[model samples]
Target: MINEPSAPTATHEFDLTTAPIESFTALQEARQEVFSSERAHDAFQRTIRGLQPTGPEGLRRGLGAWMIGDYEGACDALSAYASDDVASFTHANALMTLKRYVEAQPIFKRLAEKYPGEPKAQGGYAEACFEAALSEHGEHEIDAICEVYERELAAAGEGFADSAEGQYLAGRAAEVRRDWQLALDHFGKARELNPAMRRNLFHLGLRAERCGLDLEALVAYQQLASLAPVDLPAMMNLGMLLEDLGRDQEAAACYDVIARSRPMDRRARLYLSDAVAGMDMYYDEDQERKEDRLNQILRIPITDFELSVRARNCLNKMNIMTLGDLVKQTETELLSFKNFGETSLNEIKEILGSKSLRLGMGRQEAVLSIESTQQRYVSGENAEAMNRPILDLELSIRARRTVEYLGCLTFGDVIQHSEEELLGMPNFGVTSLTELKEKLTIFGLELKPRQ
Candidate 1:
């Protein structure tokens, strides 16, 4: 490693545990600087790296970890002690940062109850409860948690309602209740009060977009995108809106920022690619839209269409779980299955035909079936059962598809398909394999062992 100068130290050594909350304002400003100034972020990281996460310096380490966006480290380091309420707040905030909302709730609640006059504690409790409420399954449970949020807001009264943060909170609550106009109004007011406020700006842009105030949404997103320490989701939403408005160059810049930050974000990369393609001299707008439409159609789940029980069962057994998957199967393949007769065959053909597709339109070359190389031809009563039509087995679509899609024509053919082969088909997961095995057990036969 190259030798480097020491990280810049603070003007004065301060202990977070004993310091007033405002003592953090300078560091908060500095943290923002880290994003805008390359060397500053590196220095911040270096300072954080020098701190130990255990022993006497653990609390500072946790705080440093948080500043550097290492929330997991902050959670672990901060949890070591109940040093002070400030430290506890840091630990709780870290938990919330990592989306451990349930764990953060009680901490915020205790802090809120203990320091009833402290706005941060109350806000933290309300925010934590609201977030936790969204993850709850039962409607009543969600309402109960939301009730706490309402109570906390009500307790804040008129003074809180007058503030920017209060308006932002109220905007979110309105959104939860699906009061779109109210959400937009509150978010707008919050934006006016504090244009620099991060969350308020994002929600304002989102709520404005929902309300069809495109210009307003665009303005909010532009302002947000200009701020330091980038919000990836906000940037993504901004890019989408820009693309919709034919601002491909600007959209590409937004995507480029996200792509650089997260190299693994395929969506960002794809968006960037498309945006860049828009600038190409020979770009075909109509062709791009047709391709997009085709992709959308190909992604349609099989469940979206109505089919007769027999047809549905056949498709399920064939592991053809989407419209695209159905188009990949030939008439011969469908008819070859003992139970998949002309009526079911006609049903699939008609659906695909309506969508300008035909059976086997996209079929890959046939692969050799595991059955073809595996078992001996049967004889006697066992042989008779083996010769029976696959439909006679009355197996689920999953089991049926698993066996037949690999050229299984009868009960004997089904048994010839190995465990691994059966589990390899589209939408035929392990659970389906287990069910197939259990159903086969009723007929006194099991699948060929895994290869």
Candidate 2:
């Protein structure tokens, strides 16, 4: 006969169907413990190697090692499954973490275009942009490159609305464009979508406030104060807005709260002092204005105007509780009061001149009059002669094109507008208004007729 092939004997084999899922769960728990334990990073290195060619199993193994700073293991595992978008994105990130920019570039570029609006794609593109900008170029050129990436990423906005990284990139891009409105919109939208996104809300509020969107900015700062832990900026911004809104009591409350929590807050203290000083100055200016008006009308030899009750109340807060206290300071010092503007400053100067007793008299005054003179105005020239809507302002060529698309032409048309109304315009967001506000503030102008 012939030697027949003997039947293969069965080795000890665990039936996968019969095995409890708990066994795998237990393994994962064990792996996590080991991963977090000191000196146990290398414990899984051999296990990862054994898991190769097992689909995502091998990727997981590679990721664990990579997370622990094992570049070789990460590359080995990640390279084995290079076509997987998630795997490729993760691997690209690992390379970036390792400062392997040159190696990470192509991988990210490939994934970004492939997955356009995905978080991973957006993040990868942003990183690539950063890498490109940092590579041996002038700062301005780098800024331009970064801006291009920002616009592209923002336009590719699915996951970006809620991503801190996305918001940050978008904001930076807007800043590069010098488009404050776009920056504000991106930052604000990010905060609205994800309240915990760090620092974006604060920046948005500050920039908005600087552009004269005080109400909108106040809301931003308040949200920031509530959402952010120990955010000094938010508190400071809140206090500033309260002061601006003429809510002295509320401002004092905000200041006290900040001071109690952080006694070393210098800006808070300065603001409080300024508020106190402002109140007193207002009263004094009113009294002076009154005296001047009375003297002018009666043809009496009066040196100054009398303060109104409202003005007196303001002065009391500033420590200018009386006329003597008022005369001791120059017109510029009085004009520093929050509500006291250029018009008030002129009134003070005229009164002092008439009295022949200038503030600080003979000595050079510490309070130099910074009162800017107004151009002579023909009566009725300030307001628009044509009661036509604000849509006729003749905005820049680009702005006009946009407005025409939106079917707008006059100021009255814009007055009743809300954010939703304006955003409906193609390519228009809060950014356009941000620019408009800046232009208006420059001319001592306001939107909505100062209501």
Candidate 3:
């Protein structure tokens, strides 16, 4: 780590625009001192603004502007110095900041070829090519440029492996070639080398997700999202992963950032609303606890209760080994069993009566007698819509979770269930039902209606 260098003691010596740098070392030291702190930068900016330098007007003023974080001024001043190598390089760097990748590419390429031994020139050219490869309408030969990128990267070899930027360029080339695995590997290595590189972290998260590395993707996105000036893509992916992991509160926070930033993003808005609703969702713990105790009682072994040998033998033959199974049998069914006479029946009836249960009660409660009011599966007028994936509905979280839990991969499976059946799911509510109904309405479909 370089120590912070102190600013000049004299005000006159601080003017970067006028001071003729004596040597490479002096220029480097002066640049370091100027950038050491915000106060120093501001002071340098003020001094640079007040001086008239003796040199190529654009080169002197533009170089000073570039150093003090004034890209617009640098670009304006350097616009006329196309023939100067330093001006061309600085101009290309500023153009990159303004997202003029095509304009920057040739400039950096020229500089890289002219100064083959300079790592900075080569790195800049590689970056421009990578950015160009990513643009949808690149206005350049993306494949050709990617090939060039690969050649440069390969020439650097393991020497470049020691650099985060070199590995990142390799990943970008691999991505451009649709080599997902190689891209993932390079991006992962780049992230390990420099965790602070936002683009590297973003690509690492994306590649990890595509390769099914859920936990690693989650961590990568989390780190990127935590950094300043929130990255929209990172936030979106983090929210999705968090939602899938059932971290609704954290997921809501992520979606909320995107939703607030880009109000017109419908997907992000929907996700935010769903996550917030999930955070407020109700779970009937009391009802679940009561059902749990009831299930325990029902699961008790029939043999644990008092019974005549004949009764026990009859139950054993019928495979009615538990109180739950015994309850599922009606009197008529039990009577049909050979050797199960009145005394055995009376004894069984008495035992169940003591527990306030009757024969066939479990079966009665377990069966769904209501039939679908319409055809539930694909085969008719709405068959095409029914055959579509559940994702077509763009459902809110609770509804989607319930259907997914029920193994509904297509709308057909979802339509097979009644509104009450869906509402019975944990966290699924009337609002989700209404939202679902609205979406289905678009395709002229609805949940199976109950009679």
Candidate 4:
């Protein structure tokens, strides 16, 4: 017969200070020690079996299970704990790691609110908020989550930096979410406080590159290359960044170091070819000037076209910065933006139209023809090639031209000519015929067939 572990035997009042620190404390601490020692999984499991399984013991057993990669076992043991703080936090974390975000979120939030001083709980809360924000569509809910995390971290007291692990976690989360500046700041702080954390240098370099701080990124990547161990991600990343910055010889040396360890890596070989090509295409001064000009243009603030101050404020909040930016977007793209509506669009269009502009790309033919013709007229110029006699008129130029060619110069002359006679003219097809009839019809002059 299989034997099952007995139920919670000791129901004594839980004391934070004096509760018999379960035998599993030693076991939990041992698992951590074993993990730090970098022992094999089976050896760690043997150490776990030596601990007594009793009250508040479940927490250690669960943590041991977590350390040994048994997520389910960890969660089960953690759920049966006398103290909810650590076990609840660990259980929620296990759920999160298993991608059960919905299940983990509430538990994390509860723990965060209950143990506000605990950095692990705060980190878990931030993770839950981020996951929730990601599920939100259209609006950038991620920004709200980031602000929440930043605010909470600022509020956290002495234990905030107890582990550089929280800093690394927050930094990585910011990086994956494309918040480059935030990622760099967190990684930079983490590296400064814990210089032994070689990975932070690599992350700092990556985020620096993305945020357009190239010189800083190059220095960071160089440091990472020097400090990182064999098979380090930083080594490859450093070489790529150096190659991108047009230092081919230095990049080749870095790649050579990586190739020594990973000889058969096709990806590294391809990267070497790309690095060499990048050196050929690098243009320092010209590109820098272009970027400076672009940034200068981007800095110009757009005037509020919306008549009401309220509407303009709403648009500003939605990040609509320029008239040129507004014009490039379609009606659908405009409507899709948060706080933008038909009323705002109509008001903006009315304001722009008063200045002879539009909310969208203007009608090309109308604008171009008026522009070209008005200039010519202002210069006392005639665009006509020849003053031909009333024969061989181009039907495409003007309908009036076609009508005049058939001995129909005035409205009276048009009334006198039959539709069939006008149709007989060269290049005067049904399109022109229909257009003439429609024009005449508006003036109450009907075109009849000669028959």
Candidate 5:
């Protein structure tokens, strides 16, 4: 028979000063130490083992567990000391770590209200509310929570603003507001303040990508991959960028590692196959020359050509900036716009004729190609099924968040995304991709074929 560990002593009046340090101070120090340590998990376990495992000491143990990445253990230990202010704050943090943002939001709110000057309380509340909003909460609720979070942060003052956690919270708030540049700035500051914040680096990559800073995004992802080689999301994103840059062999190597690590993952397998096939694909010089010509033609501005003032004014009013933009609009669309008459349309047609192109001519072949590909992949009842709303699928919270982020509301929208596109999203990991694939399999659907 095995003996169990002894139960906690019933004493509530134990002196925290008698320990290695005051309980709250010890908790804070332990959190910082673990965050900055190279061997964070080992350091966290060792710190918690040295602490007494009852009463106020439970608070230290709980915080250490949270710092070490043991979210469930943090919840269990912290729950016993929920009556204490510091413990309650850590408990809410643990809940957030477990992705129970809805459950943690009110707890964070209570702490923020009770301690209006505490940056941790205010920042935690803000982060929880922002996460809840991302998970599909109403805009009105999110706005109210943001208002409170801002007030509390303001009250916490400059000292809080300079802290790493504060910068991270500011980054998250900026992200919720769709301010990608501001989010990236805050995340960069946070990383500078705390180099161990790998998650912030990941967020930096995501925000940079969204803001069209491709080089910055690539560097961020590369740094993160170097720090954590087994980080599938970072590796996958790096591979996608490499492939887009025409580095097929490097992209294939990234996929090969993921495939080896996750043998059962169909998405990884598919990506590896595509990358390998790409390596063997012949370069089409004629196609390249054609694309180069098309790009040069498209870059020619409408203003570069001679036109009557009235015709130029009409095109300007319609926001027709380039030859490509003008060619994409049909005669009907141009005529329907205000003050554009048949004479102006004739003038535009003449300009296009000079270039051997017609209105709305560029999209026809592209649409046909897409239609043909769609026909090849789906048929009969499956085609109808593809129109169903993505919300109908029982996806996990992480998967749902990713689909929403991509603005994919229907099965068709989801199917249009390749594995690389899905994995390129921040916070979308192997598990989420696998879950999505399983759901699609139910409808006999898969990701769009690689180009």
Candidate 6:
């Protein structure tokens, strides 16, 4: 045994002068194993332990750590030996993973300049700078960063251009510019390239929703929810989409799960209550019949009423088409018009009385509604300004449809109803409800609270 131990084998020695090529080859092998090995972290640790601490070998170890998602270890190893271009690039990447974008930008920029042919360097520099610009930078800085990102992306060549991550970055850039269609297209391409990219999926959902592609948004959110079941934002967004599509029970289940999971969360609790109320407020057969009859009554022409020629002519000249419109006018308003006297008023009252209605029956209610709406906007000196038209709010089509459906021609008509009443509309959902609330909030108003 002592004789056998006389000569130590080359493998048994910790040689500091190991060839750089051998270390590079070993690192390549380890990198492949990381993508396929079950014990990838252990493999990386073993490979890193055998490398020298201050050369290409150290850079390999750092890259291995990064490959295995050990960002802290990658930073420590790379920072110690980041003199060359490759080491510096890896160090900047580790910094990005650590969310140190401010510190990572300059290094990435330097590396990109040093190795203009490296796609990773160019892309990393663009991403780092873009992130830095987003975190409270001025518009000029954002514009400059965007220009740099676009230039680097173009220089990265066709291979990187067609890559999944490349498309994701493009989508983010388009999103910042408010180009919804372009963002959606790029995000879709990224997802097709890598179906497991949940970040891209989330962004795709947002873009789809913004573009009014409800089915696409629903599918994207569903896929993201499956990928990340406990993600609160995804869950909430999914619930909102479901509610918008009239799937109240499903939406309620979603809110209930979140509320139960986080009992102390006020937003979750409020959403749960809203979902339950929405479910309970579904239209019944009786309500449907009542709405149909009401609509029919509103469409009745004034010509159907039996009246003298003079009264009929006066009503025609006044543009009073329906019984509904006539009931909305006061006797004083009608008499103030030329050739509209007490005789014509008596005739109009007889016709309305036959239908169990009265002139100006809605006046008092209208006054109260307007006063209530004005009160909501009177924080200081904005009372008179609040009497503006609902059109001035510039709401989305969906929200505008909801308001028009409720006959809300003015801001006064809008504030007369509570949240429950608005949600009770057959076609109105959580999306329209939220949109209307946000528009009202801009004018220092909100939906009337539930009593």
Best of the candidates, TM-score: 1
- Over 1-451, each residue of candidate 3 has an lDDT whose tens digit, in order, gives 0112344442222456566544322443565456433345667777766655435644677767766546688788777777777677778777776667778888888877777655556667778867866674463576777776678677753455457778887887888777898998888888888776667898888888878988788879977875544578789999988787666655876787798779999999999888877763422332233343345446667877899999999999999987678877767688888999878988887877655465656432321110101123424787767855577688886777777666465678788889988888889889998998898889998889895
Q: Is candidate 2 or candidate 6 better by TM-score?
A: 6
Per-model TM values vs. the true structure: 0.54, 0.33, 0.42, 0.35, 0.43, 0.40
RMSD of each: 25.9, 27.1, 25.1, 28.1, 25.0, 27.7
For model 4, the local distance difference test gives: 0.55
Model 6: runs farther than 4 Å from truth?
1-100, 103-125, 138-142, 260-263, 280-451
Candidate 4, superposed: residue stretches over 4 Å from native: 1-32, 36-41, 49-58, 135-140, 144-179, 194-451
Q: Candidate 2, after superposition: displacement of residue 308 in Å?
A: 57
By lDDT, who's the top model here?
3
**lDDT (Cα atoms) of all candidates against the true structure:** 0.68, 0.54, 0.69, 0.55, 0.67, 0.66
> In terms of lDDT, which candidate is stronger, 2 or 3?
3
Q: Stretches of candidate 5 above 4 Å error? A: 1-78, 81-91, 106-118, 134-149, 223-235, 247-265, 272-451
- Per-residue lDDT over 105-201 for candidate 4, one digit per residue giving the tens place of the 0 to 100 score: 7787786677666655666666666665665532456566667666766666676754564686578667867877777878877777765454567
Candidate 5, position 109, lDDT: 81
TM-score: model 2 vs. ground truth: 0.33
Q: In every candidate, how many clashes are there? A: 4, 29, 0, 0, 0, 0
Which pairs clash (backbone N, Cα, C closer than 3 Å) in model 1? 316-397, 317-397, 317-401, 318-401
TM-score (C-alpha, index-matched) for candidate 4: 0.35
Pick by lDDT: 1 or 6, better one: 1
Tens-place lDDT per residue, model 1, 161-237, is 76676788888888777789888899889888878777789888988887787778888997787665567889999
Worst 10 residues of 6 by lDDT: 1-10
